[model samples]
Target: MALNEDLQLQALRLLQADPARSQRDLAKALGISVGRTNYCLRALLDRGWIKIQNFRNSRNKRAYLYLLTPQGIDAKARIAARFLQRKEAEYAALQAEIARLRAEVKADAET
Candidate 1:
């Protein structure tokens, strides 16, 4: 399933913040339901954006940690650029619309 832009960005940010975070911790940090977090994480994993590796914690037992693959880093960079471009375009359009509306209001007031 295609995630909304906000979800995508959130997932990227959460991963960036702590690659070793569990899905539960990530869900809490993102203020999203655990199911949704799991879904998004599954999508990311399927896309090869992250890899789960077994590592021993201080307790010496094996535990899993998520790591961003090289492809994941590239994806993050591309997403960031696209997000910036979209925001810029949206700002420009809103500014033009505001100017147009102001002009119309001024003309109406004069008449």
Candidate 2:
């Protein structure tokens, strides 16, 4: 997956997990710049996948919460399924390669 796609997926998961998380905090968790985080958020919002709500916290009254819309949840599911499928394929390939290597080593040792 590309950076934008990965960023979107991580942002969706984190926002779904914790709506009240700050953008700066999300950026830290995502290892991306705040500007990039904002860009992702804007894209999600534009797609109507996520919504922002105002919440008053002890320290910040203007804190904005990122909540996933129903559409966002559905999208997240699809993304997760695709990611799992790709990983499974990669794992199978790795296993096959390992087996091949082990057999080659055994044959060499026998000779």
Tens-digit lDDT track of model 1 for 1-111: 677766766787778778778778888987888899889888888989888776665453444677778888888888888899999999999999999999999999999
Q: Look at candidate 2 and give me any clashing residue pairs.
A: none
The numbered model that scores best in lDDT is 2
Q: On a 0 to 100 scale, what is the lDDT of residue 22 in model 1? A: 76
| lDDT per residue as tens, model 2, 6-86 | 567888999999999998999999998898888889889988899998886546777898999999999888888888898
Query: Which 10 consecutive positions of candidate 2 have the poorest summed lDDT?
Result: 1-10
- Supply the global lDDT for candidate 2: 0.88
* Model 1: residues with Cα > 4 Å off, grouped in runs: 29-31, 58-64
